[model samples]
Target: MIFAIVGPSGAGKDTLIRGALAARPDLRLVRRVITRPTESGGEDFDGVTPEEFARRQSLGHFALTWEAHGLSYGIPRDQITGPGDVIFNGSRAALPEAAQVFPGLRAILVTAPDILLAVRLAARGRETAQDIRSRLSRASFEMPAGIAFRTVINDASPEIGIARLLAALQPVRA
Candidate 1:
């Protein structure tokens, strides 16, 4: 099984994923290869330069790849294989393509209220105030019509978010 964990910037997707993984050790958390610096906090990922990322993609190293915020992100091909369930910090645009690759794929769309999302994005300190505003304006919570997904609102706390994610992933029994 493959589950795509997706949401707007600063929706606490990575934090929620980390907490859920701690409790459910059997689940596989797909490690992404991203162009962002490793020091930029959120999800733990394999950091690579844009050149390297393109090279890897050209070599067919990624099962899925998408570009956002002027950076390239890729999920390694091997990570999504095998019998056990795997979760990726996914992209909304790439979900359609991913669904084609993994038949039993489902999505977990993590979200927060606009105000909370703005605060969270600003708190990250990675993006400037203008950038944060631009993101908040562009990021929509509306999922594609007819796409099968579970929505998790990470508004209250990390614990609540983890519980929601765990419940959504109940199909992936460990």
Candidate 2:
């Protein structure tokens, strides 16, 4: 199963996944190909230029792809190996498409109040006030009908969010 984690820019999706990994080494964290610079912190992804990303996408290297915040992100076709649950930092808009690729895909929607999201985004310093506002405005998304999913409110610490994710994944694991 591919467990795709989706949320707004500063919802701490990476932070929650980092904690979940520490607790469950059996779970795999799928690295993504992103247009962001490699030096940018948070999720560790293969950074590529727009040209390189386009070339790779054209070669059928990616199983899923999406654009957000003026950047492109992709999940390589090879990353969708069979069997165990593989976790990925994914976009909310692409969840249905990912589910189509991995039929047993489970979505974990990490979210927080708009106020909290704005604060967290500001703290990251990755985007300006205007950029953060734009993100916050489009924060909510309607999940594709019938896609197995659960929502986790990451309003507090990463530890709390991790616990919620683990609990949500328990039934799916069983």
Candidate models: Cα lDDT each? 0.87, 0.87
Candidate 1's residue-wise lDDT over 1-174, tens digit each? 788999899899999999888988777999999998888877789998999999999999998898888999999999887766788899887788888877888999998888998999888789999899888976794666656898898898799889988999887445
lDDT of 2 by residue, 26-110 (tens): 7888899999898997678999999999999999999999998899999998877866678999988888788888887889888
Off by over 4 Å in 1: 172-174
Off by over 4 Å in 2: none
Q: Report the C-alpha displacement of residue 59, candidate 2, in angstroms.
A: 1.4
Write down the RMSD of all candidates, one decimal each.
Answer: 2.2, 1.7
In candidate 2, how many Å is residue 123 off?
0.8
Per model, how many backbone clashes are there? 0, 0
